[model samples]
Target: MFRVFKTCHLFKQNKIFTRRMAAVNLKSLSEDKIYEFLNSFDTVLTDCDGVLWMDMTPIENSPEVMNKFHDHGRQTFYITNNSTKTREEFLAKCSKLNFHATKNNILCTSYLAACYLQDLGFKKKVYVVGSEGVSKELEQVGIDHCGVGPDTIKPGVPYKTFERDPDVGAVIVGFDEHFSYPKLLKAASYLSDENVHFVGTNTDERFPMDGNIVVPGTGSLVRCVETCAERKAVIVGKPDTYISKAIIKRFNINPKRTLMIGDRCNTDILLGTRCGFQTLLVLSGVTSLTEVNTWKQSNSQDELDLLPDYYVDKLGDLLPYLEKFKPTNASATMLKFFSKSLRVSMAHMLANKENYERFATQRSNNSLLAVTYSLSYIRIDSKLCNQSHVTSANPSIIVPIRPDITEYEFLFTGNHTMAASNLKSLSEEELKRFVNSFDVVLSDCDGVLWVENEPIPGSPEVVRRLKLIGKKFFYVTNNNTKTRAEFLEKCEKLQYQAKLEEMMCTSYLVAAYLKEKKFNKKVYIVGKEAIGKELNAVGIEYIGLGPDPLVGDSLGMIENFNPDPDVGAVVVGFDDQISYPKIAKAATYVQNPDVHFIGTNCDNQRPSPNSNIFPGSGCMLRVIEAAANRKAVLLGKPEPYISQTIISKYGLNPERTLMIGDKGDTDILLGKRCGFKTLLVLSGVTSLKDLEKWKRSEDKEERDLVPDYYTDKLSDLLPMLSNS
Candidate 1:
């Protein structure tokens, strides 16, 4: 028989029995759906500022409350959405509040946001919309910031606007009680109209006062402008995954095994629900038992997704609510929450904090259990694009009918992800099936097809498979500066066939777009002379930036050419004349932001035979883009320009396009971020090993980095497409 250790009040005289009861209570957790959810992870992630504490002090009993987790030997990382303070400051606050914390245990969003901006290549003049704290935080990362003071650009000030000068790139937002209509309107107008960014400090609606009322917080200001602009404010505050991710990055907290405990449902509960943590709502703070009772009574409460797994008056008071907490060691109650009966009740039971958190742990990644209770608008199973089959023994569990919204199914899954090779292995029937399900394909040159100028396994056969089937495909490569004729010739010599039009190298598109821009000045050609020939055809003069760049170099023109103001664009490509003299001159010209700095493409490097290591166009692009402190508009594969070209060439519909690639950074992320369904292939570039590292990261931006579908190789995906 299962031991029901209902309450600790029963064990005052016998410490051993109380210990036994604790174990028994833990056992009951496995048996009871709610207990299992509470025990799913051993780490707790919490946010500061508006979460655990207010401005200078913690919410009542927050320390004694958090001590319960510490006593359990669970890791606790205090994550803050604000960036102004360093770990030292956080630890000081923790000490003051009696919440145990070390520098390592604190993950600050200000720190992470600064790092994120840096990684995305931002280190320029910053326009901040917060107090001094926001500006000071960004400055630590060597980022220059100009605050919202009157001096930067005041009334009656003639400042440079976008059409006149586009250098003022970033606009960061934070809480400011002094936010006026004039200031708010300008921030909204600028952020909405151009590429200027809009980032917020946090999203807390109102801060809790010492009394019953709440004070409007920074989030209210952010929402006001964001609503006016019709743009989603990039939150840098609590409950934002970006902040939660800092714990994973700094302390290596596995999101799969983390829990968040707090009192308020809105802040603590929201963090737990969004950050993929087990949330325990303690009724010792602002939220009350009456509210829960009222929500249940009225049947009008919402955000059922964010409901906590367990409800207790306090951490020390949990022994009473654990009526179902402790059970016999052998009790199988934990598995009960995972039963098919749960899914049916999921839609209704979610609003009940006690019921929702219990079974949420049983949910698999990309499964409904984890997401069903978080964002109401997010369909947990929607990404899979398949009808969910009801589980066994839960025959009465009415599966929710699919909504009328556009349904998107995962294109490849299960065994289909294992057997595939390049897209060509698909039979004619398979080809039609793939084209039916997917509309675009991205192919590479080099090792994917040829190894050091020799055809690899299944070269022409793959090309013919696509040609015969007439599947829309583009030769997407990082190699820029080389013309279409060059890739086509290489294809013919290597026993693979490709047409000039079918070839979509970054080199040709960039050169063509530059030519069309009609800068009509001297081009500082950094790559081979052949690249210069194409530019020359567009009526632009080319000066050699190197010796013997393959396309053309007559009079040591590359090394000796002094850049003239007439030098419209310093076009950097893969250059063999990679001598010190060339690098210095090119770097000098790029630093002048007024000059047009162009790179062939953004690929860092590529592997090959003999020399084995050669710089890709991206490496060259980075050099110029960094010096200018601006993101170069890439004209290559999956970029809108390239996407447009590909779509127009094959008359392919953009919505139907599917980009298949092995690397998540370049291929999957590019395709998906560009609004195409992406299928990550394991055949080249990316691997399972890479995904393992990516998963351990706290970067929330990586969320979109996931592939719509994944496969060991492209060949395996054919069956799924054909079957679909």
Candidate 2:
């Protein structure tokens, strides 16, 4: 028998449980409905500990259910609030329990603690009031830390006698077996200076109570420090959304299709709800049905966030439906909060609370209908489009709705929906008109045309369609790793027609810059064969092509490195075989002050198809700049050099051109600077969240990175092109 709490009489007798939440019970569903529900999600983000097992013991059939979920082509991630265990430790635990796991699949607060400090560019030592887990994570990021070992209680000594480390910049609190008055005093003393960062692993008040034993969790220690320090700490665990932000940033998660499963309401369910992920509550842990009923009767907004969209007796309950499921592309009707045209649809559907209550109360099919935030909107599934006009509502409050899209799936970073009173998204007519206005299309090759070595789905067809429509096409790339000939071959392999004159590469532009200046000297190159080939093609002499051999010193003296007299410039690009000798040689050449320094591009990371990021040319260029104490003239996108080359050589008009790429900082900013329209596609590196960062930033350079328009993928535009 399922647990039932009749807290119905605790509140106003008129209110009911269904009014607060209509969570669907999977056990009540038919086999077909169960299959459909199971197949709806592509990813499952489950809370560790209670949901999977209790301490070290595995929950019955939970591991089997997880393996089954993975078998059905669904991605599974273990999200946990426990900060006492490092990711490696957690992975070991998962392995011991026979659970399928990987390092990338886990997001624990201990790891988040280290990531937080790293993001802040912290170089100082961390004073930890936790375990080896937090210290291990900090060590992994090359962050020095202290205060990990047991601090034995000294009953007679005063707290003021303890000396604090001057280098400590942050105090971290987690589960500690040796937490005492001395340690607490040390943490509080460090935090007395308000400038010091205070990070708490989580705020979980208590651990799951073993009968007759109530063990205090990490929060108890954190609260002790908070009380003594009289300062609030930034929580790095779930329900705070810091971990969620980091996870989404690392893996481009589509919230709409992602399912967050957990056993607790406050942390697990609330996080999923706050992040706009579909939530499922299991009844095997901390929260009981009685607490849910109490919250429902209270009618608290915060309480409402804790409610789950669906609930089950246990996670293993869905195991039977795994093999029988058939995934489909269909989606539920979505209400677009930011689109102004939605007002018309709002009038037709149920409006106001009274109307919604009547419609909701009439339904008794046991199927849950989760009516989330935004009351002034009606339900309709539609695609988002760009609009030129700004409405009275804050433009940042945009919430796009498509049958297949969700708030999480939107992938842009921003606060929760700020009720759009008068905002607008473009209509179908506006989109068609927008597409027809562009006469020439200039696209970034790495992210826009192809990802890694493979072409993005439907991209080649889009290029062919644009060519068929008489739109002049050009492939622009900041990847100096590949020569123009290599890029041309890649285009041809992907069925994209190309010409030598129509392509603009950083290496080619560097060659052009050298040729135009009539440099009659050799270059100290810190790049690959691609740059060498381009330079050789333009009749420019160069050295430092292959690995620069290290010079050995027999005595206790430094090896005297000298630059060739003929070297008049230092050129850097993406070199997989870069070495200290090469950097020393390049730096030695550029330090002459007469020698010019030119970098191919400044892209930080190269995007890969399998979602891995490799450090790009910018890293090498920065190394040379730091060593030489001078900046290089960057010649790629967003820099005027490449744009100058294309305009001067091809006579391309900026007014009729459209720049497309997956990177906003380069492709979008370049378009804005060159007076051309820009479109950001999600098929590559740049996520909707990354674009939103630049949109919200107060810096002009950041604001300039915003794209004129965006699409989920490049293929999304194919239908519009066909219609046009």
Candidate 3:
């Protein structure tokens, strides 16, 4: 929310200063201030869905307030993040609801997406992972597209056998109730090509619906595609500035005088803030007053931008306020209010003993002073008292008349929390202390020691040095593509000394888990030969190791399909030859209450150095889960199974154990979940940008991803070790 202020005189010892008020309640303002506010803006941009109407129902007197805007000759535009409807459809809905909207006034994401592509002169067809609204808008702009309706997995046709359309040059993602496994596969496959443009309609996580039922929105589908594709899409809706650009291009309006109204803060209010528009938040939708207050106290500038200039219970509440201010008498009301001498009685009263004590008592909780004077208010945050002077007469009263103090000096203060740790900058003594503090080291294989088949520079030397220092090292990996022995061989080839007993691969873990359960039934596999080899090494019987391609139609395959009566567990890992038939078979077997479902890991995609994305086992696992309507028992990093096994087997103290990896979601999160100290190396999946985001995130899950220590790479530790 942008900070907005009406000019107010601050008379202190014949000195004056201007200050802004933010997140104010409009109804609390005096009649003159309200009249001034009404006359301030000529253009009004309001969000639909939650502000004007919810679904098909109009919010109380909202239509009256909007229609009044038209009566007063204020230009109105309906802006929405909803991508499910075209501009024509939106205009019709407006007409039906009596909001007095024209087709030109509607700015939905679907229309904006069309405008974006049209402006780019894109000629090729679009492969859409969305609804008909997106496709219809594209068609209106003379752009060809496909993949609008349901695209279910064909019985006889393997997913890999589906040919790529040569004409597809872009992939647009929006709201789609028909989102399925086949659509995900197609979108991911199309996005594999570097030339294909990916555009998402909006990033709204869910709809603002009342009741216990939660409706997932387009953002969920967009993120799913982004994960599987390993590419960030160009967002075309709120908080992206695309729609703002569209509005600016079409209308000649002053941003300073424009009023942007909405219910959601991240999207609607953020958009207004970015465009320098006055923002009004209504509590009839997603964001609440508690959230706004929380954001106000946040140290992050990103979260601060979500604050609105003013808020109300709902948009309809403004109708009564609007009724009081008529165009004929608005000027007279403002003039009459300004003609009177500004009062210092409120400030003078604060100087008295009884009044000061009462004021201090009221503000004791938050240490904040808010004094309302006439039509304006003054807020003095006691937290910013480092440089300011306190009056001798009253020690609690802050003197605001200092010659050097700027108007905004009291408002903006720097008070930051200390960072956890940065390993690269640690002194030699500190480094030695850190090394001696930990007895056991749990290191991720892929990102920490190596990326793919290549070892990271100096990683082997660091491992050798750590081992020489008597640190118990364990190669913890989520990679199920290789057996423990095979992983040990790779470690040896990479010049890192490791034993088979120290290698903790997911494949071996799965086999060990089933073996410990003492089950005699065969295992159904949806992975490569490594899982099969691991099971065989454990003297366990299994089937479905290699590719099981779909050969015929669904009805024919159903008649021929035979469920293995002896199969008691389904193990899923990385399979390069993963097909529709494999997923179908796995889903079918897992549907039975008796059959166990296990997944190697939930790592979305393998970290790649280039544009090409390698879909991880999690992608296959999700596809099978979606088809089966059941969750897999995951066995990997971030899950306590492997960590518990390591702790129990070695009898190691968790407080003295260190977990080091490059992925925050898996490795760092696992360390946090357990009692291990975490060190994040920015050599693989997680980067400095990701670290900063997690550090500032309001979500506890995102904050949990922050590691205790971080460095550019694991190789940087070699210098510290050598010095120590």
Candidate 4:
């Protein structure tokens, strides 16, 4: 059946042939081989869009080939990632295109979404970010839903005034032309509750379109919601195992005996390979023969999995093969003979397995060799097969390692080869040169200057000495729980020299931002009294300062919600009394596209006594961000706002300024981003171990957290600069 030609001249001479390349040209096989390939499978699953028809036009002879499969008693199923149509609509299209299909045979994503929820025993309403097809499918399953059509943002109507439906407990993302900010807001708001379920129909980034025109797919919308909600969705379409699970549960088909025919390798071929089905790639759709060949050459397992077992120029090309293998009374006897011959050949090969393995190992060490048969394919590449026991003649292939170096030491040495230098390791002369390199110093408060009410030993003295040496010092803290004056008072209490103008608290930064914008509207506060006081200093009216706990159920709260129409900005900071009502109100106000949303800081946690972890303002800000489905303008350390303000106001050269702190992510990263010299002290949040971790991190952001220099504590610098 597999006609092995002495000279491979029938195909293109320029193309290199390899036994590992599984995408065999179906036309290259003999007539008997084609018949055996066709008879190997009893069930067929085919993609609809590009294989059967492209939009409305059917490919030539494709319908006849598919219909012939049904005629041959093969169970046929139409699977698609397109969520824009219902099963009934798909069936109608199939009928018009001359492809015989019933509702049971169609498996569109919209219908699958409904089935997914139904299987979960979901009784609550669904918040749909899709089209009428999805809503219609939900209707068929007796599921309540909303948000199908255009829900445009109205002029002058604040999003805070919009009421939330109490019954909506799930959000489903699919393709929708009317994907607006309002829909994203509602969907994210519902998904903010951890109890709410989230589902995505598919993750195809875009649709296949002609010419240079590119249309975004449902994946774009799904990603947007996922980003705002800060959660992942359960995908129910191709490439995911959910569709196969559904098919297995409903039909109980044998994966080994099933044939998957598709045009796309990423979704179709990948799904088939994952499900243990024989894959046939049609070149008429999204994939091409050149792309298949490229995948065959790749060493990556992911790329290798994309290669199909067989490929043809088009689905219509299979018509000739099917016609030649038409059923007859002699077909059964021929199939029996073919099966008997395969068993006998396999048994014979097994008898000489030891000799074959020895030869394979010898050949693998010399060169890459593969022997593919019609029934089974085996590749003998030493690089891929892990035959470590086989000796090679080439001595260069063996890599020697130093016995003295531990694995951890080797890895750490490589990872930290270009990491930050230790400031304490510098000589007294070098330390003096480093001290004189910068004229201005920006210091963080909590971790660097002091921890809570107690100052780190000798830190105050170091600050005083730096100032005495003519260095311009400023206190920059992300703590928004206190006003600038209160911070200055604390600095004085801790024996640190500071002035009113030298303090740069986040509360002051928020007030300054609004004042510079010349904003005249009232501010909605989701923080403590310090923010309100700062706004008062700038002559800005503010509300929502104290406790505003939830009263009754969420439904009643929404019904009686009365948003302040005059409010124009929502400011988020640290709140000791953060409540559901405050978060809900802030989210609602920020939803209005015109309203400014500001976050004081993004610190996840703060240092506390007795080893207690205290949640910071970042936690509260994320809650509001998730509910509003929008990012807030950050004004804390590492965000550039503080550095930009200081540079603009004081006319300090960034290259000549030094930033000293005890946190790498905030303090040191801020200095790095602003082009300031960074010095990390281990007297507070960050330690020497944290620095080592950052130096070994593969993430650029984490690596950037490494400071220009590091020390055990702020006091360590005092001994280095004693003479100076």
Predicted model with the maximum TM-score: 3
* Candidate 2 residue 625 C-alpha distance from true site, Å: 56
| Higher-scoring candidate on TM-score, 2 or 4 | 4
Summing lDDT over every window of 10 consecutive residues in candidate 3, give the lowest-scoring window: 12-21
- 526 Cα displacement, candidate 4 (Å): 31
Candidate 3 has a TM-score of 0.56
Q: Candidate 2: minimum summed lDDT over ten consecutive residues — where?
A: 1-10
Cα lDDT over the full model 1: 0.54
**Looking at candidate 1, what is the lDDT of residue 141?**
79
Which RMSD values do the candidates have, in order?
A: 21.5, 25.8, 12.4, 14.3
Q: Quote model 1's TM-score.
A: 0.40
lDDT of each: 0.54, 0.71, 0.77, 0.76
Count of clashes, each model: 32, 3, 4, 0
Point to the candidate with the largest lDDT. 3
The digit string of per-residue lDDT tens for model 4 on 548-603 reads 65567433555467788999999999875565467667877876889899999887
Q: 653 in model 1: Cα distance from truth in Å?
A: 49
Over the stretch 176-225, how does candidate 2's per-residue lDDT look in tens digits? Answer: 75554456557867887788999999876555533422344566567656
Each candidate structure's TM-score, on Cα atoms with residue i matched to residue i, is 0.40, 0.46, 0.56, 0.52
C-alpha lDDT of candidate 2 relative to the true structure: 0.71
* Candidate 4 worst ten-residue window by lDDT: 7-16
Winner on lDDT between 3 and 4 is 3
RMSD of 3: 12.4
